[model samples]
Target: MSSINGKTIWVTGASSGIGKSLALKLSSYQCNLILSSRNKEELLKVKELCGGSNTISILPLDLTNHHQMEEIAEKAISKFGSVDMLVNNAGISQRSLIIETKVEVYEQLMQINYLGTVALSKAILPHFIANKSGHYVTVTSLMGKFGSPYRSGYCGAKHALHGFFDVMRMEHEKDGVKVTLVCPGFVQTNVAKNALTADGSPQKDDDVATQNGITPELAAKKMISAIEKGKFEVYIGGKEVKGIYLKRFFPKLLHKVVLKSHVR
Candidate 1:
């Protein structure tokens, strides 16, 4: 088991959705929590919800600001002396078609989702290496493993995450660092509403599939389980999880099925 109970865990995007749920759930484990997001007010609210105890700290973060990750990482380690886990759950989504999307949108997607995550992880890598133990839990989308119609740039960024983390795992396993890549189908969250559209504006609307998906609480629980079990990668969802296998062994079929489902 991963001894997550007594260690320190830093969660990005901890203001809401799965990140908030994870903060709430991890609180019971008696672990030191560092909650981060762009919304300091909301993060303070979550910190209070977790009993407002000293065990939990809030560090406001904007993943797009990659240049500051090193400084931020240093501060995080100083908070509790060391961090045992870093959950890369902060990212944006897309809701635009390929033809209508602007190049700027694609660039923004890569900046926030792929490059930002890589930057933060790299900032924390040396700490983990020196300590000889760390875990990276990335909350990507099922779209990471396969292409989707409307989320072209989103899929591209998520796919890029898989490649980078896979290499990171290969090189760092000997250093006692583990990587857990989580591809979720959809758990009720504001992802759809916050998704960037063709012109790089927020969709600011609810999606039916998203609203009806599993709760963020449930997703958080499953994610913790995967982390404790030291899984290389885990998919969480209803039938949508079958898409992973389909994409692997039956690419053409998965493509046809995805198109027929009309995911947006």
Candidate 2:
């Protein structure tokens, strides 16, 4: 049996993509799930698809509203008595060049993708500390490890997560809290379609790389394995994941390649 069996897991962004896939995957493990997203109706649909009315509860949430995160955390914990794990998967993406992107766009990405995750994690810290056993799984991106063209704001936000979560892991290690940063290169999802453009409007179109990416279900399985093994970080996706390694081992070479690729 999986170590996740019977655990109470709260998954944000459960309406679609990796979050939805992870919810469905965890359902088969017999875990109690509290699924959250801004769209209540979509959350219900995902819950129904999971086929476990008794084990799944829907909680509509907007990560951008950081002020309410503490209350949301309480509600999540109340649902299953205590939340044993939190999957901080709710986030937005950007598809604009740094110079073309507005300042507000940067703030929007930081608020939703970085600050929101941090706020929620802080809200849950007390619970995790009291229990002395809890896990935090955050879905970052390969961009978090290195920058890419047209994703300057997205890269900044994701990079911020690495710094924040790393400190969290270090300080909370003695409290028996586990933190796993899952960096995905690209998985077939609406992320590109929903990405913010230079004018703060949705791109409304998918990227070629995203269209050819792996299925969200496959990514979820790998994430679960990383979580079970208590990995501090994991990279998922196609050859794009190799960029992370190249950046670490051959910075000058990767720099030239990134500029030449003209990604986006």
Q: For residues 1-264, what per-residue lDDT tens digits would candidate 1 score against the true structure?
A: 346878999999999999999999999887999999999999999999999999999998988898999999999999999999999999999999899999999999999999999999999999999999999999888999988788999999999999999999999999999999999987899999999999999999988889888999999999999998899999998888999999999999998998898777
Candidate 1 ranges beyond 4 A from true positions:
none
TM-score of 2: 0.98
- Residue pairs whose backbone atoms clash in candidate 2: none
TM-score of each: 0.98, 0.98
Error of 1 at 203 (Å): 0.4
After superposition of all CA atoms, the RMSD between model 1 and the true structure is 1.0
Worst 10 residues of 1 by lDDT: 1-10
